[model samples]
Target: MDHAPALVVCLTTVSDEKQAEALARTLLQERVAACVQVDAPIRSFYCWDGKDCVDRELRLVIKTTRERATALQQTILRCHPYDQPQVVILDCSGADPGYAHWVGENTTED
Candidate 1:
């Protein structure tokens, strides 16, 4: 099956579940993301400033098309409380045709 050209899955880690849910709702309300799945707490190890740290964070899995990526990211930045939020975009291929079409249809064209 042919997948949507711009289809993508965006990932981000939030400080807590509350923040994750709020971000998800805002993205959906703004029509920037077709769906947002909030995952359980995850242990993350990274360096910040000059120190290494470990944190418990909630993960947000966002589904949208590349056309809406910029807008989606902007929304996240605007709503995110963290100084530097993790926003990773992953290209998607071989997706279920119906689901891919749904994502495209739900998100804004630009």
Candidate 2:
């Protein structure tokens, strides 16, 4: 097991399950994400354009490394259906050592 100090998790919302799966597959295929957890039928309430809005969406939890973050963001933007997609990154202080190692090694360059 290889230990790394930090990992990166990307959270993004998709219009539907299919879109979520597609994005996940693309990221995995491109080795931009080691894994992606998809949660669908999520109820989202937020303010947009100074108005409160609610919608159903699917969320993708992408597991990767800090090195892959910028590229991952770009790919998500390219494939996302929304004009302005929500792609947020979380810094992880610890995780499964082997899994983290895999994530660090898998991603590609910009």
**Top-scoring candidate (TM-score):** 1
Off by over 4 Å in 1: 1-5
lDDT of 2 by residue, 42-78 (tens): 9999999999999999889998888888888989999
In model 2, the Cα lDDT at residue 80 comes to 87
Weakest lDDT window of 10 consecutive positions for candidate 1: 1-10
- TM-scores, one per candidate: 0.91, 0.88
Model 2: lDDT of residue 2 = 39
Steric clashes per prediction? 0, 0
Q: Compared with the true structure, what per-residue lDDT tens digits does model 1 show for residues 71-93?
A: 88999889997999998988888
Best by lDDT: 1
* lDDT measured at residue 5 in model 2 versus the true structure, 0 to 100: 34
After the best TM-score superposition of candidate 1, give how far the Cα of residue 98 lies from its true spot, in angstroms: 0.6
| Alpha carbon lDDT at 47, candidate 2 | 92
Q: What shift in Å separates residue 100 of candidate 2 from its native position after superposition?
A: 0.8
Off-target runs (Cα >4 Å) in candidate 2 are 1-5, 108-110
Root-mean-square deviation per candidate: 2.0, 2.0
Candidate 2 overall lDDT versus native: 0.86
